[model samples]
Target: MLPAVPDRAVDELGRTEGGPETLGLLVRDQHTRRLLLLRAVLDAAESAGPGVCPAAALARLREDWALLEEAERLEPSAHRRGRPYRDGPVSGRPDGSVPVSEGPRGSVPVSEGPRGSVPVSEGGAVPGNRPPPSPVRALLLHPLTGPWARDTLRALRSGTGPLTGRDTREPARALAHFGSLAAVAAARAGVSYAVRLTAHDGVLTLPSLGALRTGGPGSGETEVAVVHRRGRLTLRRPGEADVVVRLQSGAGAWSEAAAWTSAYTLPGLVLDSAAVPLDDLDPYRTARGGPRPDTLSGPAVLDEADRKHWLHTWSGTAAALGLGGERRLAEAVTLLRCLVPLAAPPGSVPGGAGGSCSGTRREAFGAVLSSAPATATVFAATLVHEIQHTKLAALSEMMTLHHAGPEARHFAPWRPDPRPYDNLLQGAYSHLALADFFQRSALAATLPTLRDAAWAEHARYQAQVGAVLPALVGSGDLTVRGRKFVDRMVEVYERLAEQPPPRGHAARATAYVQAARALWTRRHAPGE
Candidate 1:
């Protein structure tokens, strides 16, 4: 049997009890799920056809899988767990990949603060003149979340006759990525092998590693040459430049290799991460205004100005976190891996004096789709709020918190319409965090103006949590564990509530909730 989260840990997470340690366990669980999905993808391809997904391509995947398995056997801990959430979106793009760090368990460490320009924290370099760390997980994940994998899985169940050439090519093309990833592994282990990869739109992508310009129609073989021998990689193709990547000795950030390719590695505040590129290089990357999960605004690609703006905001956010407490910023960095920027909503400023925290996001195990922040506080608040979604999604996947049922009738204080039981739970948990954030901000705010704003926001969210809690418990959706989870959450809520509301803030918040509920009832109540 696969590893199970200890019952105690689950309950602790339910109540928002455990800190980063608990969150780490949840992140680890996500890594396991990604692995299972990888196996599923490979199996699906294996059973399909030598035609749909080329025989040669499938064979290379098998070869790499063998090597990865051997690596795991040699160092079982290397595959134990990977970086947390940053897979694909939750709804349309579920079952995406998480980058598993290759090395002994806990061998990789997050970089400390920002580096010179890139904030990446690659752990110890490989000793002596060895190759780079394995690119196994990243190799699998990037393509798996892209349209190709989605279509491949869809076609398998389409029940439509044999897949058309159009359908077959994407998976075939996806299979080609293994060549690039395998090359990295071969370089790391000093193995000898060759794997030819085809390109899409003239780009040969190696997920999490890098890409090469393989100029040809999406159909032809773009590979110039792929030869791996005796610790040297010779990927020279025609007149094109060779695949020249500088491998770091110790376990390096996967984003670092991406620097060699078209991928844009984001220079984070204290953490290092990469933007999900839209260069044809990343088959999964969505173009501007591309279709996305309904909960998301279309993800925006960064231009030069946007990239600079992103980094500057991050610097401000880091400063904001410094005031909130180390734990606050620390937790945000740990939960977030990728930021999918969305166009800012009209009528709202991106950066007011304080941050807006108004980014449209979903609980994708991978990204937090956001707009630019209005203030550092808004950026900080967005992190605090989104991390709740991250935790709850992982928790739900790890174990059932609620029974299977159609449960969209609960009153969520934040929404005008009645939300599903799941939505209600997520909203309440996040409100709990929002209340906590404002409380911390109110205390930390030096300027009188800022302190008052923080206190008011704190009151409002605290009241929202209070109003929603009873509705959540009364929904009859929670299972035994779910009940325990909510009950524990209530304990935290009550403790937080004990801190007296600011001035008449309590009455104002309650009245505001009541008025909103009354309006909702007029519009949505039974028989309306």
Candidate 2:
């Protein structure tokens, strides 16, 4: 498990009097609120079993107002509405359920306040009327009640929020753990967490804490309540059964039976307990103004066989790469929170597709699994490659790399179109990680065939990097610091490049990548 934040530092809320602007940029914009919340919870959890007080949590938010504002400014305008909520037919309610009506868009206007401050009501209810609406309910009714509302409720309920502590390292790890749990939970359910914020009269409705009536895993369970008490999360009567499952700290475990039995039928694939089988959702094909091939729609069925297959591949790959430990897996899962399984498009190769969102959507990291069956090695390499992209995206938010401007486009070895300096950097960084993965796999493989394959992969990636590095090094678009960062990356790549692959295979791998590059340039490059 990752190290815990010290009580005093967490209590202090990790801020300094006046730090360099670049220091603030080091942390990704999307992660600001979450990082603060997790650190606060860790501090509170350590002090008392029940967690921190609501008032204290609110105060902590005030302290981190600056960071929160910066994050908000950087968030994409399209996603400012928080998670997407769907308006559809209702399923049967398990128990203790209330009727939920879909209201008009912008039914409730969100009141603005200073960055992280809870939006306050303009006026109180008349004395003759029923008592004033609960602040929490009113806040929930507002459209913008996303991270602010969630964090405040957690703090109010658990008495934990951000602290005044200056320690950043421990809190970062705790946030990573928190992210991992959320990702694992999403993967298990075959559905991303929908931020369903609704209000009937003065009552507030939050779907995340409420039971999902979908007939999938835990579908039979009439009501599933999420309880945060004593620094732990509990799912009461999860699945279509009468059993309670506790999500322990650091590592999370779920009921295998519940996971297998639950199934959600969606547009493209049926998400069951174990595996996500691809359907005609046509997720592999990208179209203009339409959802990306990786975009998920509707409910998914959870299949036991599929889920087990996925877990086996995931866990087995982790073990093969010596990353099978629970904490490491959790971190990887956290980094790869979204999993979209895609059906291969016409004339397309069957392979995994990876992507990471920019700006405030950094946490929205995900990959689309191919319809084809792949070995554990393929899955492992894909995971490492995609997660590395996510890591770089997050890092880019904090530091200036290439100079900002429209610069001449250069060929990215992997892509057909010319890319700007930044996109080139992204490809290079991800391929570098791929090369490293192959290098490590080469060392770890026991079978001669597998070992040879790993070497071939390493050489392929190395050559791809070599093809692009010269352009990156010579480009005037890079800042001095950015150039230095690239230099360090080159150093690592050069060291690995020296490790020759199996004799004949090395030359063949290099030739293949070079030939591909030449073909791409011929097809896409502008004529002199």
Candidate 3:
């Protein structure tokens, strides 16, 4: 059973007056927040008439504070805040057990009702003069741990929907549109959801109720139904025999059942604590970056032990880097879904391999780590590098940075092979982040040896960035927006370079980058 929600509680909007108690539930649990938001939309649709008045919704939320609070004191810490992604075992069933009948659960059957099916108009304002309703007919689910959440909430409160290029409408059509929009947003955001919608008898059903699945058969399933009861809105689900769990009023009774299935065993990767072996690789795994094998030849799972150790390392790194806020840390982790282990090829470094698929498969932004890292520091650094790739990939979708043309391959200091303009941009952005990470480490280092090592790393990354920035600026491949992006990157590097490192370390780092460039030119240049 879940803990009861506080009566006087804050929501994602920081509104403390009477709102839906479920918002309090969403504030507490980051994993299930999206599911609850979906539930709210379905409920609102069932209750609303032809038109959904934003004013009426807001008024209802304000008057219903008591049911949600229930005498429990709402604490600030109960709200979802940014924290390091912990690898500790996610305690719960992979697919939560719902008390439903023993049978193969299929899609809900559509049935006729007394009111009859109301044919929803495709898109337009209501016939009569009613104040423009909220654009967000479907509730927007914000990330519990990132800056995006705050931005989304602000937009929602201001009567704007996060989804673009969609016609907002009454409840039935709005629910359908939201399902499609959410899937697109999740793919772009590097997140995944098990969302399925079925409409029957003027009601909608969310099968799976926001739980992530491993696609294994015979797993238990839960379905949430939004229906009208005696002209009042109610959310219903099956319970013990002859008993149905019906939730009405503003109280958040269904909050406890929402659980986050963070870890599971995929075809080629084991996320969280699952001990399943990888027999075949998922086709979604990208072929770029690292070696792509047909099947698993060696260890391909991120086990429980490694997860705990790496999370500890990440926590320490975040503290050292002054990234204590939930938003900052969540920015890194929210885009990172899972880590898969890979076997290194012959004659290659065993434990020093990391590959990101953000460029090719933006939807599957999980990193494939080659062999477990020898230390937490290595693992943390690899995570930082890979997630940066995901961030840049998402940004590229929003704004076109480079011109569309035949790929212009160029010499990259880190990769042995020549890289295309897009890949080059990805590397530059990631290395810039690495430089920031090292700078933070250097500043926070307690011992002289550690400080010196950190400073050397910081200088090395700066030199690499300095080398790449010029090529990016001169490539002539960047669009106007692309040029602006590269210019901002250059500005950051210039600021960091102003903070000079130890004289000897700076010289060596600069010389190393120059030599690497020279070697690349000799090999890859025309008529060398």
Candidate 4:
């Protein structure tokens, strides 16, 4: 069952962004929500009862589910933190299942929810807001969202009133592919597990772990025996043995080498025993950095050197993030399972001045789509900012914060054009996190020059969020509770603003706020 959220927790998220319990609860809740989707998918297929589902695939699906159950059976801590597990749906129902709908990407909002902001993904053209993944784990494989899992769940339930299962074909087949999670779960629970893992586009992409590039063609189905035991995760196939790169230490190579059958597998990143893949090889994630600042929709392959560059950049980013705050860094690491690199545009100046974004779906909850920054500090800032969006996106699933539609009608300092109310909330929330980061940095900086730079950033985002609060509170778009949430945010701004900004920044921060609105007014209003 999904954990119940306290009303006060909602207010606390608004007031303080989030601390341990709040953040932990959000992460824990996501893990539960993903499980809920997995269960619902199982139910939908079983109720179809072998008559509709392909018999062989159906049996495998049951085994797949069984293996996951076995992982829990052997180790119940599968539900606890630091255990394992995303990239699926959220539960709003008593049974912890999402009522299937026929809208855009799985869940069709019958009441019409707002579309998410577009970014580095999908040709830099705007894609719809990525709400919670519609609980279908299949969406995790392919980058595209469509409709069809025919005779599966979408077709089984008609006019179910609001959710959409047709976003992809063969969702049941997709569910079977989900069997790949069995080994991942077992390793996480520190128990032994073995299961036939399905290859997606010639790869077994394990969410928290890494992918096994089985060297199969894109046109067919291939299965590999994925086994986890004694702190090791291994993939076995026919005629080929792929090498594994330990993403993080803790894992040992399998002692049993005789198990064979995975076909033509190529060496890739292998994660076991609590290792999380900071991956770039996964197809669903951006392979190369694109123009979009946050999300990368397009996919490309990075050469070995490029891959090395990413590892180096991340190593630096992780170290720099450590300086932010001990507890905050720990929470960030927990919430941040992986980082996908965002390629810097040519001629880009040194340091952060680039884009990065956190995941919006259940399957990708702890991941971020980011660019490689030259400076560690700016890179850390991008993470701090993006993680806030991650937090808020998860929170939005827990509570209805605003009713902003698709239309852009509000001012956001971060955006040039007007933004939708929901988008505005995301920006304010993230900027608050940034403001806090800068505040801490400014205080910690020893040099006068460094302190000034940090405080300027602190002043800019702090003022920006505060100036925009009225639009959020008065916009008539936020729900009553959402207003209360924003109200707490206003209080936070006031408390932070009371300390005067460094020299030249009070006016500069005010101008930064005024300048953004002025530019927005000029473009949006033009005549005014």
Better of 2 and 4 by TM-score: 4
Please give, for residues 438-473, the per-residue lDDT of candidate 3 as tens digits.
Answer: 776777678898788878888898888888877888
The residue ranges of model 3 lying beyond 4 angstroms of the native Cα positions read 1-299, 302-317, 320-330, 344-360, 365-371
lDDT of 4 by residue, 140-214 (tens): 221111111222345334323344534333544555545644455445455555566677567666644455666
lDDT of 2 by residue, 154-238 (tens): 4333323455443322222222222223322322222222211112222211211212222433322133333332222334433
TM-score of each: 0.72, 0.49, 0.46, 0.68
Give the least accurate 10-residue stretch of model 4, judged by summed lDDT.
111-120
| Per-candidate alpha-carbon RMSD to the true structure | 9.0, 18.6, 18.4, 11.1
lDDT of 2 at 314: 53
Q: Deviation in angstroms for 494 in model 3?
A: 0.7
Better of 2 and 3 by TM-score: 2
Off by over 4 Å in 4: 1-8, 47-53, 76-169, 186-196, 206-210, 216-220, 223-276, 283-327, 345-352, 355-363, 526-528
Better of 3 and 4 by lDDT: 4
Model 3 TM-score relative to the real fold = 0.46
RMSD of 1: 9.0
Model 1: how far is 190 from its true place, Å?
A: 6.2
